[model samples]
Target: MDKYTGKRLDGRYEIHELIGSGGMALVYRAYDEIDDRTVAIKILKDEFLGNEEFIRRFKNESKAIAVLSHPNIVKVYDVSFGDRIQYIVEEYIDGITLKEYLDQQKEVKWKEAIHFTIQILRALQHAHEKGIVHRDIKPQNIMLLQDGTIKVTDFGIARFSRSETRTMTDKAIGSVHYIAPEQARGDLTDEKADIYSVGVMLYEMITGQLPFEADSAVSVAIMQLQADPKPPKEINPNIPDGLEEITLKAMQKNPVQRYQSAAEMLRDIEEFRRNPSIRFQYKYFIDEKPTKYIDAINTVKGTEQPVYNDNYEYEEEPVRNPKKKKKSTASLVITGIAAAFLIVAVGFGLAALLHSCSSGPQDVPLPNFVGHNYDDVKNNPAYKNFKFITETKNDSSQKAGTILGQNPKAGTVVKSNSDVTLTINAGGKMVTIPDLTNKTQDEAVSNLQQLNLTYDVLPVEDANVTKGYVQNTDPPAGTQVAEGSKVSVYVSTGSGGEKVAVPAIIDETLDAAKKDIAAAGLTVGKITTKDDTGKPKDTVIETTPLPGVQVAKGSSVSIVVSSGNKSEKSIDIFVHLPKNVTHDINLKAYLGNELQTEKTVNPSYNDVCQLTFTGTSGKKQLTIQLDGNKYQVYTLDFDAGTFKQDESYPYTENSSASESVSGPITPAD
Candidate 1:
């Protein structure tokens, strides 16, 4: 098992098992205690923690997805880019990757392929419109749910089209077999490149083979740049003509000939879906030879018919009689002379009209531009006579790119061609700060960047918080701040107290782990038992504050030992008591019918009491009594280490019966 398999991160994501691994990250199936849901966490591999390039790529994926919210795209809930570890928490997908499915079945039906392609295209359309390009669009990055839904994921190599222009590497950035010709040539790529990759995937699905194959990736890249893929029909004759046309059009070697945008491609797919037999018959003349015109007698017209020239424009044949042609030419010259004189007269009239208005430039009232898109207003033909002098300011209250203020106020008469200054809102919008506690400096900064916010990191000595991780943020999390706001992030140095690394106790016997903890100058806190079929009884399977985490010496370390697949597991629950009771009360806690804890407590002395509950790893009912009157009913989650006060009853001093109540009870201290 991996070291993180049974560990918890940030005290919220409980890593259960390693589900998948990629080139630079490992994916784990974890349970989110705070959200009470299962999530998939992708952690950057330990080897690349110090590699800046890999870290950038890892951060890029989260940044790319943070701005995109589509049904066919994976959702990112959290991210942590600590110095030692980096991870992204995303929605758990209970499905297989498209690559895995393709491996199981070499080829998919054409209709099924189209269905999948449509979803992928929809996802790309959303990303493209947001100025994002998923350079890597291959089967490996596509997830297929059991219900036939397609999810596009893995944006590690994605690029923002508006801000970024060139590729980071000299070689191709994506899979060689699926990348566009321009990508293989190391040319600047855009949304069209993603369309090409989608086309390649469609080809593989329909033909059950790659378009180009060679001994090495470099050779395959060459093929992508120069080779023409065999038509899908040749490999699979059942492919619809229109579908084939769409695929080939998308796979065109030149970007100009390919689908301009994902939306444009979707329209073609929609047309085909409406009518399967429809044929676009799109023609390309780039590779064809010049057309040859053969001489033939014109049956309808005794004179030779007009012939097409190299430019595809029509030209009349030369006349055979010179005298007749000369007469015609002279007539044409006379008409040309008359036309030239008419043009000169018209030009003089226009010049006179312009001279009349030359005294003063044409003037028009300046129209209101505030609350309108600056680009729309600037590009409007009505405003063409005026030159716009644009300035931008960060105003989170207004929509980005919208005109916030205009000089030469609306209704003011401004001369034509006059420079009008317009102030546009540059800040995107306001965003609520997400919980940044326990996140590392890099992770917090990345999150701030995603929201268009800036940050300053402050390293403070804190013993309660992990070293190198965020202890808190200025204004705290959940505060709604405008975009571009500077937030100060406080990071823990773990130096306020003498710190010791939590000794590795996973897989060790409970007695052995206890001895290790004692040797490390830490006392054993609580030992919880979980039913793990993979481990032997009494073997430690997990630990609190995880191994290698630095904590103050003498601090209590908790361990979770395996019960060896027992029918039931042991759990600990904390029962709250009223601390201001004037007299002693009999406090009894019952887990179902079994009495777990029975004690006489003076509420003024003890504010809380601990109770042990035995049950399987699921919700269990707990009944607590105050002086024989049912005080509260609680539901406990053993696996998540959480509980909810389902029902509460008010207990008055010397009251004979329990009074019904609402909400949770607070321990009066």
Candidate 2:
């Protein structure tokens, strides 16, 4: 009956004050005499104490979570039933619940959204691994610590709420706008259900809005079954693409389609966190109109207008002729008197109103409310009327609750009772970033996931961090990246990791050259040749990285072979010269400034002649004479000593020189 302050309960805890009261219990900030520390003690509400089922569930969950040792989960210290009452002692938290934070912020930035998501994910991951699913995962159950860390409370309370001993009906259990679809349907719940709730929280955090809504709770539940909400990007375009995909995937209707495991989803998002660009492509569908409502509205009977009663002032006045001017002098005199009285009455009323307006509270200077904690303002009697604009930021410049900057500058003049709006800084402040290089793509992603970062993946070549490892990342690390930023990672798929062989290019013609390369899983780059070889130009003579040698992707392989010049080798090639091949129409031939040592020719073409020789000056030459004509000559020119029809002329070994050129060639005139 009295205020709860410093009154010992059951000789173990001294209740300092009643901190809060809810539907099922009264919470007090108490000192545990045994431990000599401040602890939060929640005594079951009077209504619940009488129900055995409620007491049993309360005892079970209290013991269950009290033993839980997760960093993200709230820890219960003790659970006891004494003096015909059940109470649970828990570690006192100094920060506000996530619901309080979300209530303060209608819309959170992508960075904040991701940061919150990751924290929730970590907590969920732990719970899922432990075989405990937080059936009711919503903002109200999440808490935001001063250090920018998150804590999840009420891990197993939903199951407790299922018992008949609960005060409120299950119908009113979950906070509006956050209950998952299956929970509403009373279906079996698992980890996927918790994930769905988290997705809803994420959607709300980023957009300051909900994806689905309805006039009644039932309709909202039904909407969840059939309607897919728009992606966060549609709500707030600033939301990172990867984060949006992560959110949508978590909220998928089919449990199987949803995350298979909390860790798996976390890993994927973490992978995305490494390269935020690898986004999930969403396929959205419009809702089909319900036929039941449409049919009812269409089939409704029509109504007709009712007739007015004759006696209901329906008669119209007869029109007066304009020419019939006014004649009543006494009426005019009365009208003047009435008008004068009205003026006097209005003048006095105006004077009274002015007199009242001139006597209001003096303009008092506003106090310095910036940087002051919310509780300080919320508790003050004088400043109780002082409007509070609470903001949470992840800033290294100031403490979590400390204010960074304020509006209306402190000490400004204002009406004494008027509520002044204060603009406090959200602590998690940040900016651009630095390079994330020399890290594995997985490692980079894990960091980003923890940092609530988003990035894209671009395949890049690198000697470090092998394939699938990060080559480098854009927005460079430590560059003050804003929360929810897209950080792109160039992962080294290490040149796709496999090598295609270099095809045989020595004897192939230009056309066959490319085909062979293709067959070997390789492609041609640039083709070069040496003239004076008497072979077709553009023909693949030899390949760099050389044939049969393995090379990395995109490596250039130049095909160096022979030019079109003919002398030491030719096929169906004719030559013109002076009529009398007079004595030594002396000539010299060379292949790209080199003597052709091994050359060949076909004896079938008697008109053709070929030779591989060294000149008198120690220079190599190859010249041919056909029917008294100097067919051709190279830099290592040879004298037209004799005109020979046969003898299987000189040429290069295994030469495809006799082959004609083909394949997408640019013809020469």
Best by lDDT: 1
RMSD of each: 30.2, 31.9
Candidate No. with top TM-score: 1
The residue-by-residue lDDT of candidate 2 on 1-669, one tens digit each, is 223455687788998655565656778878988988989888886546655555655675675575457888887888888757778888876566777666654345666677888888888777666566666678877877655678888653544223222222123235446655555544455667778888888888888888887775555655676577886777776565667778888888767677767777778777765544344565645346541211001111244221111011011222323563453466878978886897688655754564365547567777787677544454454564345555545655554445554555688887655656554444454554545676776677787877766666555444446766666666665676555656766677554445544555666687888777765556678777675543467665555654544465445567777876534432221222233223223222223444333233334333223333333222333344322222344232232111222212322232232233221111134
Please write out the lDDT profile of model 1 over residues 546-647, one tens digit for every residue: 565556789998888888874655555555677557677777677766667767877677776767666657777788888766787877666443455577
Lowest summed-lDDT stretch of 10 residues in model 2? 306-315
lDDT of 1: 0.76
Question: What's model 2's TM-score?
Answer: 0.41
Model 1 segments beyond 4 Å from truth? 288-669
- Evaluated at residue 481, the lDDT of candidate 1 is 69
Q: Given candidate 1, what's the lDDT at residue 259?
A: 92
Error of 1 at 400 (Å): 52
